[model samples]
Target chain A: MADTDKSPDSSRRSERSRRAILDASLALVGEVGYNKLTIEAIAARAGVGKQTIYRWWPSKAAVLLEASMALSGDAEDEGEWTGFPDTGDIAADLKHVLRLTVDQFNDEKYEAPARALTAAGAIDRELGEKFTRQLLEPALVLYENRLRAAQAAGQIDADIDVRIAVEMIVGPLTHRWLQRTNPLTHDFADTCVDQVLRGIAPR
Target chain B: MADTDKSPDSSRRSERSRRAILDASLALVGEVGYNKLTIEAIAARAGVGKQTIYRWWPSKAAVLLEASMALSGDAEDEGEWTGFPDTGDIAADLKHVLRLTVDQFNDEKYEAPARALTAAGAIDRELGEKFTRQLLEPALVLYENRLRAAQAAGQIDADIDVRIAVEMIVGPLTHRWLQRTNPLTHDFADTCVDQVLRGIAPR
Candidate 1:
């Protein structure tokens, strides 16, 4: 086939089918979870040929990975992982983003799909790696970047290991959400910001 | 139906079957996960009739819950919530328990069963609350008591919310474990204690 044979119309058709496939994949994954989420199920739900999905994505993991990206708006960002937001007030910026996270955690639309992906990642290693590479590492880079900025501004101790420090902030909020241990709210977000900024030790 | 005339032999036999059932239930949950696990399977695996399982536990969740407590150790304490340790050095106690926690998180034997039960708890509120009571609350009380002691000692800020502070330490480690985001280690524990104690600000 000539280079001209790869035309815009064909590309558009492929893109539409791909979008349908991803939507169905994500929805089914959330409804039934990953193990029960199958190639046949996705095709049946998407109203597309199973061969069409296989032609584009290699496996259920690949399909779910892309579906999750679509769910997270990664396509618009392409594949570039820009790290955390760095407004001048590191504390406020961090709090602001965390507050948004609280909202996302509380939102039903986002929760189920995210849970589906996460549950699958728990037991499946290769899928887990794909999730880390495609979704999680990017989010973490943002944290690392924000911490580096804090270090540069002398807002944080220069000797601090930023990678581990990021977890200090994220781990608790995530723990609350994943474990359903407590209500994660704006007040909870404020508490997290307060504790992280001020030493827990008596000043 | 005279109570005093009841055969002790039947009751003893019933108690033995109960242990066998719980053991089999945990083994199946650890292997097949909660969703795919069944009463029939538990009964068959235990070499007991299905009626024997239903006569005690109401569902697979109940079975798993009892099995979880059984496998996690009989805890032999007087059925009360245990709080954190107090070496008077707040940081040291937190680190010591967390180091033990790192061992628990990495233990292959507990890992799958714990992960499966935890994942189920993630989406099911009633089950989640039960887990919090049976599995999580005891640990929290320990921290609560420890923090109270520290408050009295002025090791930590007196006005600080102990529950929130405890979550700060717990949230990150759990997020890392559940999300497959990173490793939890003794170094990770030490760093969390140091950073949290010092606060993230330049001291």
Candidate 2:
């Protein structure tokens, strides 16, 4: 085969292997949980050799991190996915995004793997930091950017720290979802946005 | 021996055994993490038989639950510890309590066991619900009661749902603590309380 033709063919084959490995990691972690997930199992499930996975990823946690990033639509080509929307109304825009978050949290496809990753991260500090940097930090940046725009538009108090503001808006939903304290619903998301916008103190 | 004398002697022995068991469970979980914690190790550490632990608790989670409750000063006879203070100033009271929580989360003695239990609960639904009900719900209720009192005093909006309000006040701190995304400090706690009260939107 010509060198040019060989390069594209090999690249396509490598891409297929990468996706299979990531998919296998997610499915295995969901079935057996993070603790039991191993390179051997992922290799078997992906129909690839253990060395193939090792060459591509450093550890099971690394593989799971990429899988989760891909699942959340924040993978390598994340620029293709537009971030938090600005409908010119911060309240409505926040609510719209949060309601979608509520749906994502409730989806079965996301739930099992998320629980596994979160559970693992809670116990493993090193893994937790990596997970946060790769999977969580990008998402937080989006919130910060949106809040910055709102501040510029005079929708938010200029004096407020947007980093802390972002946490206050999203933290309640994350807490409820993690603790399973109550049902996650669009109404709950809307209430959080409204309450944050208008302080709980008497108006 | 006199029957009355024997009664008191046996009761003292039982009380000593119970305290030992609870302490051992906490220490063992801290050393081994929750997944590796076992009834046998706790019994050995406490200098009691496995049957004694089994008699008092159904599983390792039950033992750990009681241990955590005792550590938090929320076990039986909790009235003496005093619930969330109602000092007529909601902001001051919340910041005070949250600062204390920051200290507790940072304590080395509390960190290991808490991480283990929290990690285990994240992956195990049955245990997670029990942990929430036993360890988390009471703390949340304290926040709820404080918010309700603020509402009654006309400090907070009467229309707000106290449950959701409580989450907003505490959730950011919890998120930061669990994720280790940032330092948990008195300043951070105070900021969270202030932000929730005054809100992010313009004055």
Candidate 3:
């Protein structure tokens, strides 16, 4: 949503090279994990110079973040979703997004590399904070927007804190993925969505 | 709450040793991390024999898990909640628990070991699951019981799934702690409880 004016030709060419870099990053990271991945290795596999890789992105973390965003299609797909779904029915909208999320979690290519970045972030405070700003926070905005819309629509109860409400939907999926306690599936997503819309108290 | 059985003589002796082991395990793990922390190191540090360490724990990860839990005080406090507060108000009950959680997260002793175990858990699935069952899951069960009781007391909207709802509360805090995006404070905990209650819509 931020950049909408890149010319098609330039964009397409950039996309091609970007895809190559991402593919290289993913394969290398998957094979050796992040600590051992090198710019030289990325360039060799990407068929671009170390300069090319660094010119577009500053560090391995940057490249990997973009590469991850681009490759998993989580970034691309979620990038489009931007904030939250706005399909009128708040519950249905949340479920729809979460279901798509479940599919992305199932992607094998995304899983290993994704896990590597997340684990690294936990230890590396700088990298983790940057990721939140560049990656996680943008996605959170989508939730913020949707929650606001829901409030305006009177679907959500009055006096709800938009930030906290957003977490209700986001928290469970993340918990499942980070912990790997259970499968992140459509059914589970639906259950989470349903649970949040209404309270757990007996009516 | 389970086998932390109390006694005048044996129990106190056991508790003291358990504390020593947990303290040793936590310090050693923080010093060396999960990959390198060994039974020998932990036992040596605790001034107890390696067999004494093994008599209680089967592996380094288990020792670390229990150590981290014990360090957090969550292990001892599990069933001690006596269920969520019921001052005829569900939100208040939640806020009370969350406030205590904030205090726990802020404790310096818990922070290093918790971070260490959590980081290791991310990469080691079996240990991660074990950590969940022994540490995270039991704590989560406390929330579940609270939600169920809230349902019976007619505080929440009967239809909500307590499991999912509880995750919403837990997920954000865990995500923040593990990722270190922001501080976990009593105010934030209160916000989480309040927001989930009214829902996240602009009122």
Candidate 4:
């Protein structure tokens, strides 16, 4: 317990504290929401000194951002990160991913924290940019990579902008989820994939 | 000025107060955001009593909702509400609408209040549903109507759900605007329209 910072035991204790802080962040944000979330509260919930949190993360948003990333399997542990699937069938692959998205969006544990972050980001430009860069952008890169692969395979049109193309697949689901305009369903996910891939116009 | 509510002069005065209240609501929301905005502030800014606002609208969200509707030309003045255009060329028409949306989203005056409401809606389920039904749904209906017309003209696939089809056109634009993922531009709008109409697959 008295080991120095450079020692393996010390590092293990630090890692445990980090995990506790992140888990507390997600739980607190889900309960009290991002606006009400405070560093002191997170520290209390994690059973750590407030200084410990400050030493590691700059802000509550930063803590929550990392927590959300970890929840989505986008943690810094590169070994656990799985990129978008590509089975050479772009439409089918997209549907699979989107269906999973639907399930995630519907999951109460994920929804509260995600919605809190999203809501906070909407009004706070700094947090919005940070969230976009730290969390959203990397996830988007996977879609872009998949679309590029599709282009190479002659599945997607060669001229399509993969960046914008990624939005087409993700946007409607987000819009539906955020706006609560309709039920998020597997059928809707499959429809989005079909329409985007085949186009809504008559062939 | 002592006339009753049935009097024309009293009605005109009430109309002026209503306009002032809505205008003040928009201005205050822009300056302070939805959460910080209060009935007292709006009333003070509008030069009316707090009871005046409550007498007309149930809550601040309602006041802001009306202001937003008016800003978007969706006011109860039926003659002023121009439905989505039907040029028989669905792509051209959609691009036209989306380009205007890009402009609206970019406008600072519109951006502040709209962002406030959107942020509030994200956290507050009741407000979110009210905003959707009161402000957003009507606008979505316009898109649906246009898509239905295209379907009738055989410009769109007959089997496609017009409701879902409209999302493909509007979703990306909204996602870019809200998430600030990329520039909302006429070119992006046209690309969304073209891609949705033509499908992303090789023709």
Model number with the top lDDT: 4
Better-scoring candidate (DockQ), 3 or 4: 4
Residue B19 accuracy (lDDT) in model 2: 89
DockQ order, best first, reads 4, 1, 2, 3
List, residue by residue over B1-203, the lDDT tens digit for candidate 2: 12243577887887788889999998888787788888999999999999888877888988898889888874226443466788998999989888877877898677778878877887788998999888899899988888777887878776776788778878888788778788898998888888787752334
List lDDT for all candidates, in order.
Answer: 0.76, 0.82, 0.74, 0.82
Q: Report the alpha-carbon TM-score of model 4 versus the true structure.
A: 0.91
CA deviation > 4 Å runs, candidate 2: A1-7, A74-81, A200-203, B1-6, B74-81, B199-203
B14-125: candidate 4 lDDT, tens digit per residue: 9899889989999999888888999999999999999889988888988998888777764235342356778787777888788877877888878889888988887889
| Fnat per predicted structure, each in turn | 0.67, 0.60, 0.51, 0.68
Q: Once superposed on the true structure, which residue ranges of model 3 sit more than 4 Å away at CA?
A: A1-21, A28-58, A72-85, A199-203, B1-18, B39-44, B47-56, B72-88, B197-203
Poorest 10 consecutive residues by lDDT, candidate 2 chain A: A74-83
Candidate with better TM-score, 1 vs 3:
1
Poorest 10 consecutive residues by lDDT, candidate 3 chain A? A194-203
Clashing residue pairs found in predicted model 3: A83-A142, A84-A142, A199-B157, A201-B156, A201-B158
Every model's DockQ, to 2 decimals?
0.58, 0.56, 0.36, 0.62
Worst 10 residues of 1 chain B by lDDT: B74-83
Question: Which of the CAPRI classes, incorrect, acceptable, medium or high, describes model 1?
Answer: medium
Error of 2 at A172 (Å): 0.8
* TM-scores, all models, native as reference: 0.88, 0.91, 0.77, 0.91
Error of 1 at A100 (Å): 2.2
lDDT of candidate 1 over B1-203, digit per residue (tens): 11242578977777788889988887787788777889999999999999878878788888888877876564335332134567688889988777767777888666777888887776566887899888888777887788778777877776677888888777777777777777878998888887776763333
